[model samples]
Target chain A: MQISTEELPGGVTRVRLDGRMDIAGAQSVDLKMNIVAGSAHRLLIDLEKVEFLGSMGLRSIVIPARAVHSRGGKVVLFAPTPMVESVLKTSGIDALLPVHHSLDAAIAALE
Target chain B: MLGLLAASMPEALSAWPDPRLTLTSQLEDLALVLPWLQALADRYALTASTRFAIQLCLEEALSNIVRHGYRGRANQSITVECAPSPAGELVFTIEDHAPPFDPLAPSAADAAPTPQSIDELQPGGQGIRLMRRFSSRIAWEPTPSGNRLTLAFPLAR
Candidate 1:
């Protein structure tokens, strides 16, 4: 997986992930994601390009999201493909992280 | 890690003349699984949704075998066979030589209510749930050597 970060207005960090979020992909981004979780108080994970999501991929997201939560930070998922969204919902990660299809809605949630 | 093995039909599987890919029980071998599934999807003309479901279930099931069943050990054998059933469903059989464990059995993780918050969420145990939700049917049986898991999905015509 390829991860890139852009600073958005109002102190939110947009971390965009591109590639499959399967075992290898998740491992590739785990450390960087943790770093983002530690530093950013409001985080938006952009999933628009992620084509696949497996359980390990979910762990890669959940661990970081939990870290951000403990630090009083907010995290939201944005623009997952239909199959990826189904994986999120099936695992109930959608309920915890809150998935937003609209960029405006996702950024606003972090605010 | 050793190379993946191309398996011939075992006597038990003779009824289904399907392609088989066998790998060592290592997470790295998972990288090969998607391409294998993709080839099957292309050959069978499986719908995108069905393809996704099979991929999801295979990742979950195979990873579980590597992580939990084999305890992350390397060089142990794990075989996956893919075929279409007479009932118009695509079937996948995963056989692992690690131990006899039924992944489909109802457990505490299955019974636990969905966490309302991140703090309440458990770190693992979502793989089996994903398998159940994505596959049309799942069955597990104890093999003399270890365990076998079967996952089926209806072929979208």
Candidate 2:
């Protein structure tokens, strides 16, 4: 898994995550993402390239999202593949961290 | 031209071999089985939904054995068998030499009402819930040494 972040004009940060979010992949990114989500005011994660999403992957997202929420920040997921999207929906993580199909919608949601 | 190329291609390329994996009941071993599972999914041409279900179920079962069943023990064998059944369904059997644990048995918490809010969400147990939701048929049998869990998944239409 690969995680790269870009700072938007505002305090929003766009984090692009590619590859499977399986057990190994989640471990690679969880610590870094938690730190990122902890500091950012608004965070957007792009899951367009993520090929798989498992329970551990859900933990990676949920933990960081909760951290951000606790700090009065917001975190959103965008463009998850169909498979990943279904996993998110089935696991009920979508209720806590909203998912969007487009960048505009994700940014707007964070607003 | 396309037809001629197709006919010339080797049958080995078209045929899918069944994927079987054996790993020890260690959390790190979870990584080793992933590629084999992916090969099984690719071989059978599993749809997105089916693949997701299989992965989730396997992770839940394997992780449970590693985390709770074995409980710091090492060198325990966890065998996994996945193949297409004669009846056209995907069958997966996981055998582990840990203490007998029946994931299908409903817990006391199962009878409780669903949480109305996320804050009230339980800390654990979601894995077993997901496995039950995804597998079409699930059965458990106690082996001489440990337990065996069998799961059948339907093909995507």
lDDT of 2 by residue, B1-157 (tens): 8778778996645766556688997889998777787777887778878877888788878988888889969888899998778777899999988888887777722632343444543334566666777889888999999999998898655
Clashes of 1: 0
Write the residue-wise lDDT of candidate 1 on B1-157 in tens digits. 1222224434343242338998899999988888888878877778888988998899889898999999988999999998889999989999988788877666624754578888987667788888889999999999999999999999876
**DockQ values of all predictions:** 0.76, 0.33
Against the unseen true structure, what C-alpha lDDT does each candidate score? 0.88, 0.80
Number of the predicted model whose DockQ against the real structure is largest: 1
In terms of lDDT, the best-performing candidate is 1
Q: Write the per-residue lDDT of candidate 1 for residues A32-111, one digit (tens) a residue.
A: 99998889899999999999899888888889899989999999999999999999998888999989999999989987
| Model 1: DockQ vs. true structure | 0.76
Top TM-score prediction, candidate number: 1
* TM-scores for the candidates: 0.91, 0.85
